[model samples]
Every structure is written in C-alpha cells, then in structure tokens.
Target: MSAPRNTAGHALVHGWKWLDGFASFFGAVVGGFYKIPGTRPIKTLLHGTWPLGHPLHPMITDLTIGGYTATVAVDVLYLITREPGVGHAADVLIVASFLTSLLSIVSGLTDWNSTYSEERRTGMLHGLLMVVASLGFIASIWLRVAGAEQRDLAIAVGIVAWLVLIVSSYFGGEMVFGYGTEVNRQAWATPPTKWERLDLSESSLDDRKPVVVKAKSGYPVFVVKLDGTVYAMGNTCTHAGGPLNEGKWVGGDRCEIECPWHASRFCVKDAKVHGGPATFSEVRFEVRAAEGRIEVRAR
Candidate 1:
C-alpha cells in the first residue's frame, strides 16, 4: 500500500510538472500569433457585438461550448444503443457543438490579442488545449458517422476531449479569477447610504462645478447642482474607480455622466447605467434642501 501511494504521489507531481511546461510553451506559441498589431483593431470591432454590457465574446463562447460538452455524456449513452433516432439526436448536438467551437475560436482569438501580456499567455494556453480537444471531438464524430460500430471509439475520444476541456476550464478560471479577465471591474464598490449635510453657506458651490465631499464614513462623494437641486453620488466610478466628478455630463434629467477612463456612463438621477464598459450602476443618494443647506441621504 505504501509503495502504491508513493508511486501515485510521484505520478501526480510529475504530471503537473509536465503540464506546467507544456502549457507554458504552447501558450507562448499561440500568444505570439495574436500579438500582431493588426489583430487589436479586429478584436476591438468584435468587442462591440458582445452582449450583456461587457465583452460578449467570452460569454457566447462559454455558453455554446459548455452546453455541448454537458450533453455529450448522455449522447454517448444513447449512441451505445445504436438507435437511429438517438444517433440522429447526437449528430445534431455534435454539429451544434462544432459550430459553436468555431465561433468560440474566432472570438477567443480576438480577446486573446487584447489581453495583458501575462494574461494573454495563460489565455493562449487555455485556448490551444480547447482547440485540440475540439478537433479530437470533431474527428470522433466523423468516425461515428462512418460506422456506428465505432461507437466505443467515439466515446473514448469524447472522454479524452472532456478531460482536456476540464484542464482548459481550470486555466480559463485562472485567467478570470487570477488575472481579472472579464470580471465585474467594480466589485469593491460601496453604495451610497448616508446623508451628508452640504455647507451651502460656503461660496465655493455657487458656481455649480462638481465638488468632492467626505461622507461620515470618510468615503469621497461627488456633488453637483442643477436647477437649484443638488444631486450626490459616489465620487469613484464603479469601473476602475475613475473620478466621476470630472466626467462630462450629457443632456438633462438624470444627466448621464461618462467615465473618463472607459467611457462608462451613469445617470445622475438614480445612478442607473446609461452605457457600457460598466455593468453595475453607481451609488445614488437622495437630497433635501433645509434652511439653505443641502442634506443628502442614501436612496
């Protein structure tokens, strides 16, 4: 038992050692392909079509491939019975997965080009492994079609592909969690919750320019005035903590303020999102005029 345990532990360590070198080398090779100057423009163009107010490429790729991978085990079981209907169903799933894999590859390349150097390398490794796994699955599907008798071969290939995908998924998780890829970009925000009394007696606010004030909690808050009404929100932009007070205001009625860094816009009235690069809304505070002084409370 001790011998077996030692052997297993050694294998595990050696396995990871090999994986680390392989992933690093392959990541460097693939990352170089997307580092060309022309790739950035194309990737930026694709980013425009991404859904959910963030980069769309990653989301779509995950959905399409994740769905297909999830269904593969069940499909394999159905194929084992040699039922014509089951085979037909599996075929549809395979084709869908293949098409999605193609789409993922294209969008992933675009995203890969824009990533930071370290993240790009890690993302490249994840992408390369996924591509190999996807190709293997595709070939397995071809074999299955050629002869249903090759069902076990197809299942074996699928299992291998699934294992590869698991490894790729781990790397992908590292890209997001470790490297901050496609993350909320605004997860550490504190919402407006306290009422601050504005010293309106001071003449500095009369010009209607944005003013920064400290909340009771010592957090910086931005205040602006329009039509005798004062509005307040967190001074920090939800995306990357940009200063929102200096941002340009567009139009009236919950005037939209655009972040200078990433151009994320938010409404002054309720802090609702007006535009992208930021999915979360700003923190808004309710204000009341009292004896020529403006007092604010969290909404």
Candidate 2:
C-alpha cells in the first residue's frame, strides 16, 4: 500500500514537496547533498568499506545503542538496590554513550547527505532525534557531575532519551527495509541453479555489448560477449540494482561495467567491485553457446 499522503508527518516530509526544497537547500549549503565526493577512497570508507560487506554507520550504531541501553540497566539497578556505585556506573555509561552517539551522528549525516528524495527527508528527522537524544545524555552527565541531588532527575531524563533513541532507530530501519537506503540490492535474489536458455539467438548479440535477458528463474541476467567469449552475471547491480546491461564499459580496457545510476563499476569477468559505493560483488554466472543459442546458469 502507498504511504498516507496526509498523515501527521506529511507536512514535515512532503508538504506540497516544499519541504524537499528546504531540505535540499539545507543539505547543499551544509554538506553538498547528492554530490558524492569524487575521492573514491574516502567515499568508500565512509559509504561502505568497513565490516567486510556492510556499511560503517551500522557497525558504529551497535556501540551507540548498546552504551545508551547499558546506562538504563545501571539506572534500574541503582533504583532497586539504592547503591551509589551503581549510579556512578550509570554516569560512566551515559558519558560513553554520548561520545559514541557523536560518531553515529556523524556517520549518519554522511550517509544522509548521499541519500535522495523522501528517504533524505526521513533521515533528516532521524538525525534530529539522535541529536536530541545526545543532548539529553549530555545534560544527564552534567547533572550527575553537579551533585547527588540531581542524580535521580538525570537518570529520568536519560531514560527518556533512550526511549527517543529507540524511536529514531525504528526510522533508521524503515529507511533500509522500506526505502532500501544503502542496502544490498540483491540480498534476497536467487540466481537460476540449472542451465537456462537465453531467449535471443547467439548471432544477435554484438561483441562487448551487454544485454539483459531473463533466465529460466526469471531474474534478469546480464550477458556480454568479449574476445569471442561470452560472460554472464546478474543484471542487477549489487550496489542499488541499477541495470548493469544498460551500463557502459569502463576501465578503458572493457573489463568493467560502470552503473549508470551510482557509477558503481563491476568487473565483467568476475563481477567483483572495481569501484566504490558497492562493497558486495555481483553474482557471477557461467555461460556457453550451443548451436544457435546462448545458455547460462549460476556459478
């Protein structure tokens, strides 16, 4: 079902689409939205280089959520035992959570600047909530350091902040599972296991030109012929499902297909990433020509 057009957050996200303009303006003035930095290494690192195939922001979020939740656990323990040491431990956790939240906030903003359309608007609200949560934690720290009389109130606010953080996290998940921001495009995809016949005549394919044809399993398969040899891989780009068949050959040697959408380059020979914004490799396939037809299957 389509999302509610006039819901509570409608104005905040898409009030006649005017909010998009303001958001675009804000992002451009602050951090050059939609213009991913040309520095490949830096963009790769910030975008999705660490944690093997995952983005760094998600890795850092574990600490942010864990540290904040730890403080709540300590707070409850203090309330139950009336132990001063437990309160002290809660203070430490709060401070740590605040620090890690800074990193999470920064990484999130970096990702946010790269996001577009409604997802970008949703991310803005997510980041704002995180900032509010951070402020609450900082305030809790100040109050705890001030005196014992403020400890109870500080814990109260800290718990409230933790709650807000949870809500913000829900939005984050929505962005990924719902809008597919920074998510692997082929995570649920399954290539055909058995050999599948290509619909086109082998002679129809031109050398070095990629063609997108449906495999037996029906998922799009990218087929390319080079040097009298045919190659096949998943038609969907691993980065964002951009049509690889529509992409142009890159690397000046025709070894890669540069995605037209995000410019994520994949090696035509192996489907491995030859560039940034796509950490995962595309699914490779084996192909053979028989008589007048081309056949392919998952590798």
Candidate 3:
C-alpha cells in the first residue's frame, strides 16, 4: 500500500512539473505575438474599452469557475447515465466557459502589462497557466462533441481539463495574495481633516496650472485651480505611481487629467476614472480659501 501511495504522489508531482513547463513554453510564444509593434495598435484599441482598474479579473474568474463547475457536473452525469440531453446541455455551458476564459485572458493581460516589475513575471506565469487550462478544456469539449464511440476517452479528457484549471487557479491566488497584485494602493491612506495652507502667494500658481505640493505627511499632492476653486489629489498615478502633476489636463469643467505614461484619465471633482489603464480613482482632497490664502486637506 505504501509503495502504491508513493508512486501516485510521484506521478502527480511529475505531471504538474510537465504541465508547468508546457505552459511556460506556450505562454512565451503567445506573449511574443502580443509584443509585436503591430500588436500595440490592437492592444490599445481593446484596452481603451476594457475596464482595467475595476478588478475585472476576479469577476471573470468567478464566472469561469461557475461555468466550468456546472459543465463538469453535467458531463460526469452524462457519462455515467449515457444521457444525450445532459451531454448537449454540458456542451453549451462548456462553450460559454471557453469564451469567458478568452475574454478574461485579454483583460488580465491588459492589466498585467502596466503592473510593477516585481509582479510582471509571476503574473505572466499565472496567465500562461490559465491559457493552457482554457485550451485543454476547449479540446475536451471538442472531443466530447465529435461523438467518439469511446465515451470513457471524453470523460478522461474532462478530468484532465479540470485538473489543469485547479492548478491555474492556485497560481492566480499566489499572484494576488503573495505579490499584492490589483490591491488598492490607497486603502491604507488617511486623508487630512484640516485644510493646510498652500504657499501660492506667488503669481506662478495663478495661471491655474497643475502643481505638485508636499503634504504634512510628506506625500506628494497635485493641485489645480480652476474658476477660483482649488482641487487637490494624490500626485501619484494610482496605476503605476506616475506623476499626476505632469499629466495633461483636457477640456474644461470635466477636469480630465491624462497620465503621461499610460494615458489613464481621471476626473478632478470626484477622482473617478474617465479612461483606461487605471481602474481606481485618485485620492481627492478637500480644499477652501481663507484670508486670501489657498488651503487644502484630504477628505
């Protein structure tokens, strides 16, 4: 019994290693296509509409998991009972899951590209594994629909596909838990309650140009004055900590500021995102004027 158990454990380990290697190889090939100069235009087009900052990955993952689980359960029952209706229903769900997985991959990659250097490699790995898992599930579904005489073979494929999905999920968990990927950077921030004076007695800030100022906590804050109203927000771009003070302001009243690095735009009034590559809003600070001096405080 001990010998058999040890053999099973070793086989599992070996299979996992092989799967990892295969995923890495294929991921590199796919990633190369995405890196091409011509692909940039396509990526930009897709990312422009994608909600990169709203935690789309988790939502996608949940949908994929639900669909896959339902498909697996239906497939298992179909195999055991030889029910064609159950198999047909499972086919529909499997196809839906595959399509969802493809969209998730696209959205995930869009966010991954702008991530910190420390997170890029591991995130690439996690995404690679998920792609492999998706492909396996697709193949399994194809084989099932092909009406193969040996139903057992289809059942075996489904089992393998589920195993791959499980492993890919584990890698994704590591990317979030260990590396803090997609976590809100401003979650721990405490905004100032009292408005601190802005030393803008000089005419330099009178033009309503954006300026960077240090708060009492020494954190950099971006300030802009429009129509006698002063607006302040965190100077750091929530996407990649790019200098928001240096970003270009577009249009009037809308207060849209676009990040120089990734072109992520945010509204000045509510700090809400107006464009892609940044899903989270900048931290907006409250401000007022007292005694001919401009003052701002965090909300």
Segments in model 2 whose C-alpha atoms lie over 4 Å from true places: 1-22, 29-38, 49-51, 79-82, 146-149, 201-207, 251-254, 274-276
- Candidate 3 matches the true fold with a TM-score of 0.75
Q: lDDT of each model, Cα atoms only?
A: 0.64, 0.77, 0.68
- lDDT score, residue 17, model 2? 59
lDDT of 3 at 57: 70
Tens digit per residue, CA lDDT, model 3, 79-174: 788888887888888889888887778767765665543345556556766777777787787787777574566667766877788877776765
Error of 2 at 126 (Å): 1.4
TM-score against native, each model: 0.63, 0.81, 0.75
Candidate 2 lDDT tens digits, 1-299:
12335444444555435446656766775465335566565555666643355677888899999999999999999989989988888888888888887778766766666567677777777776787888888888888999999888988988998999998887787666666777777888878878878897789888998889987667888888888878888888776678888888888787898888777788889878766567678888988887889888788
Q: Which candidate is the best by TM-score?
A: 2
- Candidate 1 backbone collisions, by pair: 50-56, 195-296
Model 3: residues >4 Å from true position, as ranges?
Answer: 1-53, 148-150, 198-208, 227-229, 250-255
Better of 1 and 3 by lDDT: 3
Backbone clash numbers for all candidates listed: 2, 0, 1
lDDT (tens digit, per residue) of candidate 1 on 138-245: 877887788878866876787688778778777666665566654554466554466567554333464346787766666677777755657777777654567888
The residue pairs found clashing in candidate 2 are none
Order of the predicted models by TM-score, top scorer first:
2, 3, 1
Native-vs-model 2 lDDT?
A: 0.77
